[model samples]
Target: MDITRYNSEAWDREVESGNVWTKPVSPELVRKAKAGQWEILLTPAKPVPDDWFPKLEGLRVLCLASGGGQQGPILAAVGARVTVFDNSKKQLEQDIYVAERDQLDIRTVRGEMTNLAVFSDSSFDLIVHPVSNTFVADVLPVWKEAYRVLNPKGTLISGFDNPLLHIFDYEEYEKGILKVSYSIPYSDIESLPKDQLKKQLEAREPLEFGHTLEDQIKGQIDAGFIISGFYEDNSAGKEFLDRYINTFMATKAEKVYVDKCRDLA
Candidate 1:
């Protein structure tokens, strides 16, 4: 929504600049991200469904936005031959360190998520995309590429914020048993401070970049991956909202929640 912050120059600056969170292997930010307890908060309380689990042994997997290897490392621990990919070299390198620490066999690669033709078509058994890709407005390109790279019958295990959760403000306040400052999606707007921006890059912000459910399901179908399962954990969002304004609803203005048709393409 505040994509104005991510101009073409900003994206390129991230590449040329060597800042940890901004750049990827940003050593300082990586360690900080790993050390922070907030990540544990973001993790799903319940395990992902069995059907969503990719067959680990001999299955080639790709992890997008493998920030500090949260999901990637977990999947790797389960014996998946995983290759973690991200635009941030610093982040990937940090993940590499974590993988080494855990003694997990995980590979790291740096590249844009939307275009994965660098790898062969039908090359992977599964793809794990977490809270990333919503930053790129056109997620279809990424989904299309993922389909191109995965073999027929291959699975994709992806997770992101439920769009419905996006309609809240996170400023500090209390009102209801669940204090809510509901707003129309993308209305309660504020520019992220520089430090906050880096923090977000380090800990993937699903709400900031998640596509609507309709689009996500459509992406799976169009890309040829069977939509095996979907998961939603509102505990974290609700918890966060209770302390801050739940911006999903209007705080200053009357709001309307519109259900627009989402493109699966």
Candidate 2:
């Protein structure tokens, strides 16, 4: 199966269904951004810290897999040269819709998150990636590509689900009971029961992969990112896990230059 294509189509339907992430940011928000007042989410709850960002004016920013017209428009309004890359056409359209409505300068590119061949090396100064990586099967390549495309000392801010969120049985979760029926590094495609999988397919929902903290955090480090900031957050809704512990996490990392010849010795 072409996972990227399937998830793209599913997310298009999600946009039609008014999924919160697919909704466009309001024009008023863009206006405020242009006025030097703005905040955006890298996780479900906390807004990204102001210090995590450099001067926005004239900086190249990549909104990696973070379409939905949210982050890209705000950044563009604030004077960043913005490009939003995503797998879903509808998601990309949200960015375009906001850009056109606000007359903001923004570029929208459609592609898989792991493959950033469209961009050249050291092409961006900042990459704002939200919680969308759960849909991708492998995340290390995403980190590698992000590291490659970022200029030295560039920032990478990202959010991801804690894999423990997937260890519970979904039915039990709905009942406010967290039953450990699955292991870490979970995949709805491979781990869910046949009935559950059928239901997800019938509903046209995108499949999810649950990567470990190791894969999510250490992968960035392995990709040559220096971990700088970190935080944990819970889902916004009254979910079972939210009652117990935070189910989401966000990280701020910076790319530092390394001498390849010295490393090869």
- Number of the top lDDT candidate: 2
C-alpha local distance difference test of each model: 0.53, 0.93
Give the Cα-based TM-score of candidate 1 against the true structure: 0.61
Off by over 4 Å in 2: 261-265
After superposition, candidate 1 runs with Cα above 4 Å error = 1-43, 169-207, 236-265
lDDT per residue as tens, model 1, 12-86:
454345433332222343344334311211223434555445447667877765555565665565556788887
Best by TM-score: 2
Clashes of each: 23, 0
What TM-score would every model get versus the actual structure? 0.61, 0.97
Could you give candidate 2's per-residue lDDT for residues 168-228 as a string of tens digits?
9998888888789988789888999999999998898999999988999999999999999
Ten-residue region with minimum lDDT total, candidate 2: 235-244
